[model samples]
Target: MENTATRLADIHANIARACKQARRKPEDVTLIAVSKTHEAPAIQPLIDAGQRVFGENRVQEAQGKWPALREAHPDIALHLIGQLQSNKAEEAVALFDAIHSLDRPSLLTALARAMDKAGRQVPCFVQVNIGDEAQKGGCPISELPAFLAEARAAAIPLAGLMCIPPADTEAAPFFAYLAKLAADNGVAGGLSMGMSGDYETAVMLGATHVRVGSALFGVRG
Candidate 1:
């Protein structure tokens, strides 16, 4: 594994620099080390370096490792940052500390039922298809208002907005737009935009949570 601590420090320093430029506190932004496709041995070093938040892409992948990882470090906050299937709602509710892919009514309903059954409310970041890309797995920009409203009505805790800008394009506008959407809707859950590539930009634009993967964990196999 790459030297996890050094990479984390570099990412944190970059985040600090971005926060400074934006006049925001570095502490205000949560850095979620995306641990999807990485094994527990690889993730442990980051934990040792004081990284408490992690993002996993799949329920099954996370399920395979996190339970054991969490056993050793109970303070770790695991987040679901990938497209979620309704069938896995219950498991996702039980496993993840937060959900960052709540984009559809059916998934929302499934999560609500899961939360009710589990007696735990996992905060969620509604993914917005900001680029209007057909292949993306986010709520279309047009449907966000009603979707957020539906989430609220279902009593799912909203944790701000999340988005992935179209690959290989300037991401600033998308981040800024997401910030505006959050403000317009009175969303106080904090924006969950940003990743390894454009996390600094995301931070400058008011991202409260950034999901970074390769930079910290090295490129996946």
Candidate 2:
């Protein structure tokens, strides 16, 4: 198997190529390695290779993996990128640096209560259902402005916005839309869009952070 250092260099090369194609500075886009379902053994070498930010899809999975990995590598940042249950809000708040799937008021309320109880403020991104897919778990685009207003009223730090484009859609326009929304909201950080498949397009469209899994780690078992 290729060592973590080799894999990281390869991934960085890919990011640089993508940035060149997108006409963006290589530093403008941040790569967030998605470490869901994989264990710490799989991640440690990557940490050693200097990857600090990771995205996890499930709260339970992250809760299990983070403690040990954190003990070993205290600076790693964990982001929650999956749909969050209100019941899991407290643990999620405690474990993740940022939650990227705050889609409803109930979830926000739960996170607020959890933060209050923990006495720690957590940054969060509002997931926008740009594709308007009924099966997806993001808030409707039309409801975003009001949602932001409400979140602001509640003193929740609205870090930025995240979205997943339709599977068949070209990712650039969707990513551009997200960048536009972030600009409109006056929040200049945290556009957590794009994945391994279309991250190059995402970089061109000004993605601040791109979640790359298979491209970095190979296919998950």
Candidate 3:
């Protein structure tokens, strides 16, 4: 069995190699270890090994795991990486440092209410359905300007954009398009693109954050 330290070291090394191949400094990319579906026991070792940031796909799962983890590791930064429902916005806003899937107006309104109630502002990424997949959740790229304007009016801090490229599509173009969209919109800070398989390409195209799960934790059971 691979020990936690060794597994973390191997994952870090792979990240370094990926950064080098993209001609990017390793520190330029933020690795968001997706911990959705994994139990606290499965994650505690990595936390002990010094990983302070994690991503979760569901509010309930995160709520379940975070209290214990937060008590144990006060410095951890939790991110919400899944499609968020309007009703769950309050819980998500209170828990996550960053919300990476702001796809609809109702969700945005709920988040705004949550933020106002909490007296805090949460950094958020407007998810762009770059592939235009009917099944995906995101504000279509064509409607971004209006969406962003509304978000701004609501005082939600729009930090950047997040996108998932279509399966079977080359990653470079998709990443480049995300970068371009962010640039064109004057929000050039956060590009949360790429995952385990295409992160190197994403880094090359200017992804500030990459969500990696299987590549770091091995195949999910």
**Superposed model 3: Cα runs more than 4 Å off:** 21-23
Best by TM-score: 1
Give TM-scores for every candidate, taking all chains together and pairing residue i with residue i.
0.97, 0.93, 0.94
Q: For candidate 1, lDDT tens digit of each residue in 1-221?
A: 44879899999999999999999999999999998888988889999999999999999999999988899999999999999999999999999999999999999999999999999999999999999999999999899989988999999999889999999999999999999999998898689999999999999999999999999988755
Ranking by TM-score: 1, 3, 2
- State the local distance difference test value for candidate 1: 0.93
Candidate 1, residue 37: the lDDT equals 85
For model 1, the stretches where C-alpha displacement exceeds 4 angstroms are none
User: Over the stretch 78-114, how does candidate 3's per-residue lDDT look in tens digits?
Assistant: 9999999999999898899999999989999999999
lDDT per model vs. reference? 0.93, 0.86, 0.89
Best by lDDT: 1
Clash pairs for candidate 1: 159-189, 160-189
Positional deviation of 22 in candidate 3, in angstroms?
4.2
Clashes of 2: 0
lDDT of 2 by residue, 1-221 (tens): 77678877887887798888878788877789998878888888789889999999999888887898888788888899999999999999889998899989999899989999998889999999988899999989888888888888878877789999999878888899888888887765778898989987787777878898887787755
